[model samples]
Target: MLTLGPERWGGGVIFDPAGYALTVSYVLLDAEIIQVALRDGRRVPATLIGLDLEPGLGVIKLEGEGPWPAAPLGDSSGVAVGDTTATVGVDADNDLVVAQGSVREVRSFAGYWEYMIDRAFIVAPYNPAFGGSPLVNVRGEVIGITSLRLGDRPVVNLAIPIEYFTATKDELISRGRVMSRRPRPWIGVYVFPGDHGVVVGGVSPVGPARQAGFRRGDTIVRINGEQVGSPEEFYRRLWQTPFGEEITLVVLRESRLHVLKVRSADRYRFFRTTGKPPE
Candidate 1:
């Protein structure tokens, strides 16, 4: 259980037998104290190992003994758009809740709360109660981790593919995160796709964009001289630039294009060293 003052939440599957656990970073965000509850009802303390924001994965080291039951990782690349699966997680009562489902689509999910998830697996018939729930296949192998719950006819859920964990597992284990010499550039603006260009809808209170005099309703036309046609393109282009680098941003404000230079900072760096993580 992760406790931030009085709040508590569950985490992800244990892929390591020696007490290492994998979870989303948001689960441990601003957490003052964290505990790992075992199947035998022993709630022990857990420490933050590392987190990578680019792919959005968190790792933790639970204080426990050896020979734990770990989930088998499945090849998410083989998951199809119609594959049937199941989601298992803890509910509000801390009771186990499991539901069956199938993949509805595989696409890039973006422009919501400044969250960008590429190759997100949208599954139907299962509504996730919390993050870090395992999306398992018929063979009991984990294909993805349930990250979001949206819509409800039969209750659709979103999960991050398991491959993201495997790809960054070693880096997180050793360095506590993706150790890059250069961090990704972040201006801290939440934008959406518009007919003309990428439109800024929300600005982070302490982000570079807000500090640099960016405003809401400003449509972004170009970044670092390249045109941004969509929200995804804008984010992709931003990630391509190095963190802490100065870049040119051309925006259409009041039907006129204005060029502004912004000094970007590392997003993960800002979140880790500063206050609570961005919502």
Candidate 2:
């Protein structure tokens, strides 16, 4: 079936016998209305079940008849570099478009959007239209889902390892999100790479950072007494704290160090207060 987002058309895989499907969370963001085009030329309305942003996966359900076609999920842990794989995209005629490629590598991928996938596979020579398309091994069992077009010359692409979904399916179905981990603690400060730490590029108007009197152009030196040297390090340390707790932030503003105590909140909660989309 097809997944048409607010302003774009991407595809998703029906991976469960009960009409539950999967796609990237970005396509599902702010998607108040979604329609699915079946292979038999029938369109079905879909409701978003839930989403897990850590790996950028979204679960959607087709409100239709029973026993839809579902693909078998394979063990992604056994997948290795150099293994042949294929991803299915939608063609101009709205038909399944399958492309073949080889897995180039498996590693962590951190996006500039404050997103991080602990594990992702790099595949080569495949179509980028494979967004949210299932990646199947030679056995035809799905191992991953195409996520991005990293490059073109050598055909590098990225896919979210399937195990992320299989392991959290029940949680998504129940809570609309994973509850195994509490939401990350957020101070609501936008940061950039700095000389020895993350520089505060901007502060959210109503978030903890601004409420605590933090200003722009301040360098984050430490979080709760622990020194941080980079943007990644700062985020990693901040997330380790319990949400809604007060912590001291050591920042250097114009070479003068100031200790500011701020109460952290769930990132999603802050978004709600700011009138931003929860996703």
Candidate 3:
């Protein structure tokens, strides 16, 4: 990740089953490669590991053997919605970054556990780079993996709940795969916060919507022949359709009305990470 500011790049924590070590994962905006400086002032090379896409967490491993201490993984199940939490990571120029926040909401998404927090503050006060940092409880046990901030809002960072790690640990080690749950699909694009009217901010490039000529900036007016004057009406119509079924989308774009047919793709595949596993 590119480190902002004029500060120099530095080391980060690396914990494997064997032990813990410091490695270079963050870099200055102008630096091409990251180099780790040990506690004794010796430098070493590190390699990037796989990044968990949904959670937005990335991992990297060091090359040489050295003394290192590993942090313990905590039980996320014991964490209540209002409990306090802390974040730890290295900031730009190698300084330690820490923050505190309170859990705001705890809920599930797509049958996967998740949580949100409020009043979080970070010191050394910088971005955690690419969401690989860990969020710990008061006891210093990691309960979450830092991810990206929601849109351009940096303060409201998102994290992947540790429950995903706990549930998939054995599976990750045994079969190198996590058990996946699938969502039923219906064709077409959607906009949330329906009461305010739909703003076409995104489009599935190759999904049924795109194939049907749905483009960004197209204001949806109807779904399956039903008037969709608002976001709520659009979502309601989409959900009412059967999974894997074809549907028609009629939208107003550039003052023109166009009709298109869209077929849904498997929701699970859409969220899965792409490319080869981390080295």
Candidate 4:
């Protein structure tokens, strides 16, 4: 398993009267214990409630009963490019930090780790404390949750639109996942854009891809005979197929074409959803 580290820190928003907090899912992955710090300097222990991997969102319930301030949820669909926005998060000192910026772009975003968001926000002037930060509109309503910092010279933050949450919030809180949606097939390969096409960077040690003879530097050309030009296309094609199905991958390695077959599986099967580490 890949270790993110012993300790992780990120911002989150309390968006429920019952102390349910929303944040990026990566932070809570394999977490044995969670602690939430409020602006008033109160550090309260929290418990993992659920995770929605599709949009990369997670929810945690803050311990204790009394009055939690819930941020008003806003409609992200109305958010437009060039609209004023603020990225709000807490620094290491637990002090509120806000970065003023505007929506640079609102479009689809794809990551190399088999993740994609159809409607995402690209906010400018990159917030250093972006992980789990709340992107607020002019009305001070939370419109999105900042997930990652993209680009180099002119960095921008990618915010997952709030609409994704509002649509399935109840399902996540009740079942720890959306039961209505079918699980996407996961091969566990890390791929990036290459000169000719998508190239395999590495494979998960426990994922089916590793056992299927996939190697680093293998340029992927097709999935089941369908051409894949980019990482986004690769993910879309892969997810369209049901889990546990045999997947055919054609790759160019060392100037020779090789055909590899792998049976994909549900990613949750390998992930630890409980607060306790696997015993």
Candidate 5:
């Protein structure tokens, strides 16, 4: 078991007969050390192992021997959009509680391996403190790890899909991180929304675009020699090129026409580290 403090914290029961347990990182991220209180109120020291970066999961090792009850981790891939789930965690005072909710939606972003779990028509008894709490099925098998809130609604929570755990647990447990495939080619520029067009603000050093003489503040008028109206269209065009395939970007940078051919890297690397919900 692990928690935020003697007060409010989210933890898990190590259902594994071998004593393995699961929990979320936000509950443990700032924890320099941990202590688990047994059912008998005996407190024992525990150690923080590490976390899963993409899904943001954490695992800890409790000291001393136990006959701790562990919950079986379930296959979340077997879950459907409307399936029912149970979210469990500790409240503000560290009391264990459970709330019932139906799985609402499963959304995956570009390069994301785990789908984000959303719950509808329900709310957690506890607040966002349960960042990595367990979401279980009717069979009491752990299916998801609490992750984030969808949009601006606190009641609408998200979870790191369990499949990512089953697939990467061994790797994470051993290496503390997973090596993702790198994006291969590059246009070498960062783009953002601009009035009436896409604006290039920063350039990647030694990238194809720099080699082609593209400069900052340049407006991208076309990609692949075809006219593009906006940055969205520009990105859409860039994504069309197959991975590792070289493509050309035609743009008017500082009133000069230029073309650059660049290879595309695997996109998965960018997805994991970027755009996570507030902790």
Candidate 6:
């Protein structure tokens, strides 16, 4: 539940006639007031409709009436690794910015913030407005949402496939999330790959891991006596365990092996859904 700042700017696409828009979920986190800037220099107030953390997408609704210009959604499943794409977004001046790039690879991506995507698009020629930008195909149909910029010299952007949103759009809009899917166990520990095992980079301030006696630079070796070699494996093991269950973790800290137990919680329950700043 870390706040990035008091105000954040990102691009979004209206996908419904009723002013419903879609953007990366990170932009909507801890948002108390939302104002959408249109191309015609008009800023319209908006409200948080819902958020789907699995796919890292968020829904918002304009506070005005009538139909809006909606972008056509494309099937991301049909997108190939070498497909061409256009990343479209707005800059700090509210001016439209578009970048042409090709999909370098389609693979799974794991983030240190306890986030993982099964199928993601890795696009080259990173766009400056990577966050919440729309990744459109040649036909101008929105296929994915650019979520992050990865790498340094050969910078690339990670786009979450759009199919994840379409599959559960209705449920997300209605219930503020997809209710059918089982919630995963989240300990809120930020980890990275290490030589011996997964290294603990940091822990969320509001997460159970903060009080679970996990120190920075602790190398996680096993979960419930099962060895974990990478961050992906650690996440898989963590999610496989039922939520609210105690998870035993063996860590190598300061040349000593220490055993720590932490109870996992649902991430959705820990985050604010009303777009109000935490008190």
Winner by TM-score:
6
Task: Tell me the spans in candidate 3 whose CA falls farther than 4 Å from its real position.
Answer: 1-15, 18-68, 107-130, 150-154, 173-180, 183-197, 204-208, 220-258, 266-279
Each candidate structure's count of clashing pairs: 1, 0, 2, 0, 12, 0
Q: Write the per-residue lDDT of candidate 1 for residues 1-279, one digit (tens) a residue.
A: 211235658647888888777766677655556777665666788777767666566777777677778888898988889998998787655667788878999988874445677788998776556487888999999898887777757668888999988876786787766665457678888798888888989787767888888899999999988989988888889878876788899999998999988898766645541123433
In the predicted model 1, the residue pairs found to clash are 50-176
| Candidate 4: tens digits of C-alpha lDDT, residues 157-217 | 9999999999999988888877798988998898999876799988887788989999989
Q: Write down the lDDT that model 6 would get.
A: 0.89
lDDT (0 to 1) per candidate: 0.77, 0.79, 0.51, 0.90, 0.59, 0.89
lDDT of 3 by residue, 1-279 (tens): 212344544334455544333222123222334466554556676544333333323344455764555777778766666678876766554456676775655543220111112222232223454245677788987777655454443345555566656655544333323435333453435454333235464565435676777777777767688877655456557666776778787766777887877876653343322123422
**In candidate 4, which residue pairs get closer than 3 Å at backbone N, Cα or C atoms, i.e. clash?**
none
In candidate 2, residue 133 scores what lDDT?
A: 80
Ranking of candidates on lDDT, top first: 4, 6, 2, 1, 5, 3
lDDT by residue (3-92, candidate 6, tens digit) is 467889899899899999999999997677899999999999999988888779999999888689999999999888899999998989
- The per-residue C-alpha lDDT of model 4 at residue 144 equals 99
lDDT of 2 by residue, 1-279 (tens): 122323756778998989998888777755667788887998899888877777888888999787999999899998889999988777546788888988999998766444667789998776757778888899988899888888657667799999999998898877777878777677778788889677887887657888998888999899899998877787788778888899888999888999999998765443211112355
Task: Point out where model 6 deviates above 4 Å.
Answer: 274-279
Answer with 1 or 2, whichever has the higher TM-score: 1
Error of 3 at 172 (Å): 3.7
Off by over 4 Å in 2: 1-6, 91-95, 151-155, 187-192, 199-219, 250-262, 270-279
lDDT of 3: 0.51
Which consecutive 10 residues in model 1 have the weakest lDDT in total? 270-279
